[model samples]
Target: MSEAERVPVEVAVGVLVERDAAGREGRFLLTSRPPDKVYAGYWEYPGGKVEAGETVEQALARELREELGIEIGPAHPWQTLVMDYPHARVRLNFCKVFDWTGDFQMLEGQQMAWADLPVQVKPVLPGTIPVLQWFAAERGHSGPTHLD
Candidate 1:
């Protein structure tokens, strides 16, 4: 199908789980995509596609458990964005999670990091770049401004 006729594959949800650091800016989680996945090695907030009959929160919880081995608590809906990649168009629903259980583990052999703004990870997924900018703005930092 042509680009105009193509439908987005699915709506995906992600969680930014924060770690409050005393006397320092708090950090949020970012995960590297598995080598086998499209956009492999790119960093993004942990989440997965919302399945049939599942709410975004449900998907976030499930994905975190399966991918990171953590059970999420008190996830607050934050922002939503629609992006079109070469592989598929997607709607990303990002949530800010303030609480959770279990030690964070990379169950999928993916790298994990707790990052502050201006993340050190190289090559973040294009769709996630905007989220990072939004995060910076929310933290009272100046994000990029575009001139059209």
Candidate 2:
């Protein structure tokens, strides 16, 4: 394909579920990509690609149930970001999930973590970096760049 040819962008949804710690800062959930998937072992918000005829919300709900074994509640549409990666271009639709039902489970056998700003997790997915920066900015912290 020519450089000028437009690359098709995959529409993906991301769920940001934050947990408020008593008398401390809140933390958001991040899951490790399955070993067989692209960017294996990279941490990211819980979500998946939007299927045909599915709205962003619908996709989020389905993904959460399948991946985390929870029914999402009160998810607020947050941000839309388009990022280019060597593997694929994607348009990410992010949602801020305030509530959910059921105990969190790593259904896909991936590691999960509740991370605070300036995430201590190494090698987060490139598409997720901007979202983390935004989250940090919301918490009054300077966003770190890829080099940080």
Model 1 steric clash pairs: none
**lDDT of candidate 1 at residue 19, scale 0 to 100:** 57
TM-score of each: 0.87, 0.86
Query: Per-residue lDDT of 1-148 in model 1, one digit per residue for the tens?
Result: 7777777655545655555465333777789999989989988888889899988888889999999898988668888887888888788888888888898889998998877767888778887788777777767877442211
lDDT of 1: 0.78
How would you encode candidate 2's per-residue C-alpha lDDT over 116-138 as one tens digit per residue?
76788878888888887777767
Among these predicted structures, which one has the highest TM-score?
Answer: 1
Candidate 1 at residue 103, lDDT? 89
Q: Which stretches of candidate 1 lie over 4 Å from their true place?
A: 19-25, 143-148
Q: What is candidate 2's local distance difference test score?
A: 0.78
Model 2's TM-score against the true structure: 0.86
